[model samples]
Target: MFFVDTIELAGLGNRSYLAGGAHTAVAVDPPRDLDQVIAAAVRRGVRISHVVETHIHNDYVSGGLELARVTGAAYLVPAAADVSFERIAVHDGDRVEVDAGLALRAIATPGHTPHHTSYALEEAGAAVAVFTGGSLLLGSVGRPDLVEPRLTERLARAQHTSAHRLAEELPDETAVLPTHGFGSFCSSGQAEGDHTTIGKEKAGNPALVREVDTFVAELLAGLEDVPAYYAHMGPANAVGPARIDLTPPAVADADAIAARLAAGEWVVDLRGRVAFAEGHVAGSFNFEAEGKVATYLAWLIPWGKPVTLLAESPDQLAAAQRELVRVGIDRPAAAAVGGPASWVRDGETPVSFPRATFTDLAKHLGDDVVVLDVRRDSERAGRHIAGSVHIPIHQLHKRLDDVPAGEVWVHCASGMRAAIAASLLDAAGRAVVAIDDPFAAAVEAGLTAVPR
Candidate 1:
């Protein structure tokens, strides 16, 4: 069997596959990291005979259509798949012949997306492996609402019933393989364990172990917040034919980067919001690259326009490149010469971010001080200042409605996220100010903010 996993990092979700037997193989959901999948196939000495889309992915781009086109294989999806494709659409109780005897039987399992499906592989010489995509994960079922919207209840109902159906029908010994693992918004119980058996899932998975109604209710309650970009990826995947260039971009010098910006190109500053807000190339847009870089890259960067990554140091340049490649933006033009800090050595006038140090914030902690905390939920829950209103940096766009219009002040764990949040608010016509260091400011100013 040809086995390949995309090995998505924390918060990065994807599908992986195995091509069992030398004669034919299967590509599961087609990895966004196409090179990894192609390399794995080359090692196994088998051509891909099938490309299976377990479901329409929400977080990242799908490689199924492209992989099948290159391999000359049949692309397969569930009968209910809303995606328009030129390949075979397999349904429940339908059989797809793997080899002369090996078979992949479709099982209708819809929840995360309406068209979602899983397969029970029955091969004469191989151990039974159920390809459970978001149906029965290691410790939970897939979140039901991102793609389907207000019908979270409907999807949860489908998800609850489908998980139970898989648990009851599959053999205890069947090796359960899922598309996404821990840390993915697709699954709430993503961190506890990686992979498990059908029997193990039945025993431990919270969603699968509970009764249908209870499971649905629990799924609704425990649903992790979905990324804003998730709404944009579904329709793009279903229609097929998106222009994602697989090559890394051309590197440009400092002057060339400036020229591109002058020509109206977007600059994505990967440094945290504080670093960016404190000072950045004037007219450059802010999108922090600290965590979930690839995710934000896909969301912020449009197709065809080359990306110029504003890296902190040489250390982050490689990470910046890797994140760009994950979403199929193989090429990035170049990194700023000596970091954004060193750009001034070339005699360029830098834009100063209208920001304050922690001391400045402490001194100004007057009555009606609104400290907007833009860190993630975990960070906010652990410790926060007295007047902080929590709003994670990533969801700043959607959550902007709650911010008070008058003098909205921002500060994250560090200066970075705060700057990004403040920038967005400023763009949206809000009175925004940011603190470069919130913790240090609290201590210096003698404010009664809680400490870690």
Candidate 2:
């Protein structure tokens, strides 16, 4: 019996699969960090025979080419995906035998991209599973706007048709595994859980249930801002992503770290929000290593800017580096794995900022305090503090000058982003108070929220 091992990219909410037969396996939609995929193949005791990409990804760097080169696997890509690379260009209804009695039949499932393809796996001529990369996700389809704005509406309609095609063609029991929409922004809207079946999606997927025009309108309207780095991903993937270098980078001393900081490079602190708030480098930004470090840092940091990482342990530093590399941030300028106390021993004490809850911020509301809401436009539009000024976390670095000089109280839906914003404001020599509580607590705190 053939089985599929799902390798999850938690930060992006994407999944890659290693489907193994008796002696061979196929890798589906791998990220640039390919070691995990290799490990899975090794565990299954199967030689990776094929590396398949559903499309030219716009969200993260793909590992297909590198993985193929390393494993001697046949690299496979969609026929319509324009790329300057060597690979088997598969079209609709193309079947390739991966192992004895195990074959992958490519189904042209466009919409996520014009060339998007899904692979339906079969064992002894019976449908076993379908790897639906972005076209058909848990309960919502992949957002079509990532490719081109002009084609967004048309592609969305295609997405609806693609979801139905898969549901109609594949057996009800066939496992439906998706590469996007666990928490990914690539999803048209929210969906539940990590996995589902074709029958389950057919019965409940919002996109499949709605008319094409209605689905397109709702999907386009619901999309949040695409990450700035996404513009680079599609191009990088098309050419071929640079090979991931996992070798531990050099550790920087205080003087070198100071030099980068002085040069206006980003010095990212990967400690927890609480630890960072207690004390951190005077000018460093706090994006907790455990949270959405990849998504937020890649979105917020200036592209091609040097970044120095400060972490509590080697594991934390390594984890942060792995996340960064997946988004085409190949290397940090320098990294140190001890807290600020160890790194900042040159007579200058680390800085600390006050962290207030929603209730606390409500109590302190006055003329001298300026509430900065650092959430997405959708979040602000949904509901927010009456007088809070909106500048999403992604735009805060460049839009810092727009904020009036006062005691800036920063917050997002939760404390993580607030802590990050607070650090940025503090680094710029502004007085900041981070509100570290859930957004739901606003009403409970007696803070007036402008309802959506």
Candidate 3:
């Protein structure tokens, strides 16, 4: 019997897989933190014999190299990938025996990247599952524009052919397991359902049903702003990511925290938005532990700048550290485990901002208050308050002066991003109120204008 275990990186919106027969297994697209993958192998009582990548990832650092090193397993990468390290170069039609009666067959899929490949898990000469890395997702394929801009359209056309090739060649019952599309920005569109098969995708996936021209046109039209940190990920993966360090950072006393802030280093607070809004160290930013800390912090912070962390407890700091390392923010400069009181110097009062809802925003709509919409352009295109100033959260740090002068009321799809923006505005000496309510509530309160 063959078993597959999924390792979900919910913060980054991707999934990695571990599969094989009872005794040995193969890991596909593992994340930087190998502890979880190692623990999963222990629970399954299987020795991992191979670690493979579909392509050089553009989102998070791959744990494949480190995992293979630790397990003494063969590290398998696509033959066409221009990676620096030595790896077992996998090519089309190549087969690697995973266990006594199980093996993996490589299929060149080449759409998500020029060297992307899919691996089919075959048991007793019958294919049971296929790991389609970024090519064939649940409802859509991976975006093609992450690579060189000149190759985008060509790659989009390739995606259509690749999706069709899988559908035509694989049996309808072959399980289609993909590494992207759970909510990852790598997907061209929102993916549907938790699981799917070759038969299901043929019936509904856009890449399968639409003509190549139509598919490419629509895909290009719908692409949104790429995350800023993505520019660094691909190069890091190509050069081979170094082994990560997750030991707790040096504890920062209030004096050290103050000095770091004075030197322009980021002091991030990993607390819930509500607690952060109530109180926080002046000039520190809030990236809640309860939210997508990896995605947002990496996206917004100036690359290579020093960062210090403040968490309510030791466990919160540890968890946030794990999340940050996966995206290549390897080690925090310093960390503190306590509330704002302990993070601030003696006789200094922690800064604070107010939390309000859209209803409160409604009452002050026509006053001297500036309604700031920090959602993405795509999100605001759907609907927004008529006269609100727009700036995506990722761009806010660089464009703080673009915000009009007034008491600013900020909001996003949910209140998390609004809180982050609120903290930024607060640090800039602006009077800001975080709309700590859902955007749906804005419509209910009759605050949004017609959709553009």
**Best candidate, lDDT:** 3
Question: What are the TM-scores, per candidate, against the unseen true structure?
Answer: 0.76, 0.97, 0.98
**How well does candidate 3 score on lDDT at residue 275?**
96
Worst 10-residue lDDT window for candidate 2 reads 443-452
Q: What's the C-alpha lDDT at position 80 in model 2?
A: 96
Sort by lDDT, top down from the best:
3, 2, 1
Provide the RMSD of all predictions against the true structure, rounded to 1 decimal. Answer: 5.3, 1.4, 1.0
lDDT of 1 by residue, 1-452 (tens): 33433434443654477655656778777655466677777777767788887887776667788888878888897777777768788788777777666778888888877878998888774448888877778777778878656888998888888887887888888888888765566775554656678888778777666877787777776665666666666766778745455443455566776787778676666776666666777656576666667765565455567777777766676666665554555667655634565543387766644677667666666746677888767566556777667877777766788886567778887665666677667656676677777565565666544554
Tell me the tens digit of each residue's lDDT in model 3 across 1-452.
88999999988889999997889999999999999899999999999999999999999989998899999999999999998999999999999999989999999998899999999999998888899999999999999999999999999999999999999888989999999998788988877789999999999999999999999999889888888889999999989999999999999999999999999999999999999999999999999988889999999999999999999999999999999998999999999998899988999989899999999999998888999999988789998988999999999999999999999999999999999999999999999999999999999999998873
Residue 36 displacement (Å), model 1: 1.1
Q: What lDDT score goes with residue 224 in model 1?
A: 54
Native-vs-model 3 lDDT?
A: 0.93
Q: Per-residue alpha-carbon lDDT of model 2 for 1-452, expressed as tens digits?
A: 89899998989878899997989999999989889999999899999999999889888999999999999999999999999999999999999998999999999999999999999999988788999999889989888999888998889889989988998898988899989887787877766866689888888887778887887888888888898999999999999888888777789878777788889999999999999989998899999988999999999888999999999999999999899899999988889888887777588788899988888887788756999999888888878888788899999989999998899999899788898899999999999998999888987787756675
